[model samples]
Target: MDVSKDTPQAPATAAVPDDTPPEVSRRLRLITLVATFGGLLFGYDTGVINGALPYMTDDLGLTPVTEGMVTSSLLLGAALGAVTGGRLSDARGRRRTILTLAVLFFVGALGCTLAPTTAVMVVARFVLGLAVGGASVTVPVYLAEVSPAERRGALVTRNELMIVTGQLLAFTSNAIIAQVGGESGGVWRWMLVVATLPAVVLWFGMLVMPESPRWLASQSRFNDALEVLRQVRSRQRAEAELSEVSALAVKDEQEKLGGWQDIRSTPWVRRLMFVGFGIAVVQQITGVNTIMYYGTQILTDAGFAADSALTANIANGVISVLATFVGIWLLGRVKRRPMLMAGQAGTTVALLLIGVFSLVLPSGDGRAYAVLAMTVTFLAFQQGAISPVTWLMLSEIFPMRMRGFGMGVAAVVLWLTNFVIGLVFPSLVSGIGISSTFFLFVVAGVFSLTFVKLYVPETKGRTLESLEAELRARFS
Candidate 1:
């Protein structure tokens, strides 16, 4: 339980040295800020439903079954989007795929905003989900490929920070809008429309950003790759890194290592895929999204009125954002596997407490506050540890040639898990009630912790190329 005890020291390549020119550093920061808008959109679209769904349910006359469909259609679409987006980013380019995803974000949000029927809204959310799933896979891979190994964890996790920030924005906006328009008939539409603005920002921001240098190298565009790398890395370091990247790119090409066949035929890759799938599943089964997509409803169910629940849910959003900031800093300091294990343990305990408080406490402010307290504590660990490590490790562990595809396929499992949880969570709460539903998650979390302890590798100190080599050797 002492996370620091027996932890391995970060290697020589663990931190970014103060050798890069300021301009190059600025460029890297700029790219990270722009690229992570995809994460921002992902966060907003998903989190908006927490508050919007209540209003939407009233307006659309949604039964629990239809509500689940509306809420989970995006997740189902995301399952498809993750794989398709991964393949698209690998085939067309990360920047282009994001551009395309941005378009989808805009169109989908608008569709939801103007949706006249339940079917239309579900379809629109499904479209929005495609963009979300695509962004989930592509953005991290792009950031991972562009970042220096030393800064990779921090830079790539900025996307997660953006994601939580977007969620906060959604939570905050939902509260304000509900307060102002609580009497209005179609207030949820306002909440849905706010997402389109960020989609615009993501599109324009990515237009000026550079493509992933590693992607360029994969296509044998070594000179183009070097130029892009030079924008973020020092002149000499960029050249040296380009050589390492290109050599791997060529080796992967010659070995024909980037397709479904490669994953099946190659023993090491097959093992790597197993680990990747486990990592993806572990992240979703934590029951984080249950809180995310239904925190307001849960609060209302506990004791708060509709308006108060909307406001209180912002606390969850705030905690998530703050925890993610802590998580980003921690990734720089600790090993990934231990951090993840710590998060899993923290969340499981919090969930158990929530179930207990719900079962034992009477229906009033005490039970509500206790449940809220546990949810906040849960977010602190979930965002700060489980999420950042999951995405960063996924972005880090895959082979360079198929980083997009591998992460994408893994994300399919992730989104599908999310989809099932989102869909059935309502029914579970309606059927088994929240306490037993969360107790179920507690059981799942124990399994998740065991998986991380057994299968997840430490990925903090090594470059992507070096890590891939290490994995290839260890698995082989």
Candidate 2:
């Protein structure tokens, strides 16, 4: 295997196809789906908190500020977990790392459900955050490494699809449980407990799946890497991919791997990291989480009654899932940068309207409905365009040897940014009012759009190795 720019690389592996031997593709899809349970848990925990909060606050005796803290604690934990998880996955293997995270998710969810006070809840939520953050970084990278290039975008993005679907499930469950369990002393506990099911599923799921072949090869376990690849690929295809990947791994080893030094010394890698950071920031600044975490609140502020807001929030979840489907569809066909810019542009316009609607309409049903409409529209673009691109780009941009570390660091920035926004959104809304809060988002969206236009690279239609080479050439 001559590992050069001209080497004949194996075509990226496909998910087991429907028409192909059912034995192979069927097992592959099942493995992919099971591994992605991390994603479903990620969606459920984060989205469940949105509706569960009202009941939680009353039960736990929470103030507005404390309420924000409860919501953001997981995000804060995710920030640390994202970076640590990425590095751990890189140093360990993706399979082991995800399995560890599955345990964390189970423990954290159990803790949250059983928490007796706000303090306990926050700590427990932080633990959950760690799992979510880690999952955000690890799952996509694992999927990308395992998937064939032609189906890579779709397969990798299935995690995102699961993420939103998890959120929808959270919303639906919260609504149902709240409606049915109303007046129960701790109905919110039931909401939190639902997360445990997926966590258990994730742990068991990863037990049967192979580690990413790329990660294994990166660790110099060539035989083990080949065995894993052979399970998923035709023997010929497996050998070819192993040859190419092994060559890259050897080259990376020759260069010496790991740490802040690689990032500082390698200008191209550093530049890509900057772009990754910007993408992560851009995704958050669209105020999408504002909707995810506090959608009911936003609807209430706009004009809906408490019950109506909870119900209306479901619409947000529905649109998010649907938009993600569109996003996943677009991922294969569209260039990453353009899709991002379009998402930013659409979100920016939507945020501006949200501000205007809040300011112009008198406080009543009209104002509430108008703001709700804009939020939905904002999500249509933000979830459809910005989010999927951000995750896909982060997963795709890093070199194989440093994929976990690089993406983890980027996700740390993302989760921290989310934490900051989630922490302050209530205070900001209370102090400045909805108009100003949205205006701030509008400004952030502009900066995000500019960053994408100026720095982000197009990543579609190329192998990860080729993309790395192209980025190095352009940035170097």
By TM-score, who's the top model here? 1
Give per-model TM-scores. 0.97, 0.95
Q: Evaluate all candidate structures by whole-model CA lDDT and list the values in order.
A: 0.92, 0.87
Number of the top-ranking candidate, with lDDT as the measure: 1
Of candidate 2, the 10-residue stretch with the lowest lDDT total is 1-10
Displacement of residue 103 (Cα, Å) in model 1 is 0.4
List clash counts for every candidate, in order.
0, 5
TM-score, prediction 2: 0.95
Tens-place lDDT digits, model 2, residues 1-476: 11112223324323223233556666668778988899999999999999999899989999998999999999999999999999999988999999999999999999999999999999999999999999999999999888766767888888988998999999999888988997788999999999999998899889989999999999899999999877766777677778878988898888775668999998878877887898899889888898899988889888898878888888888998999999999988876778888889999999999999999999998899888888889989988988888888899988889999999999999999999999999999989998999999999888888777777777776667666766666777
The alpha-carbon root-mean-square deviation between model 2 and the true structure, to one decimal in Å, is 3.7
Which runs of model 1 end up more than 4 angstroms from their true locations? 1-18
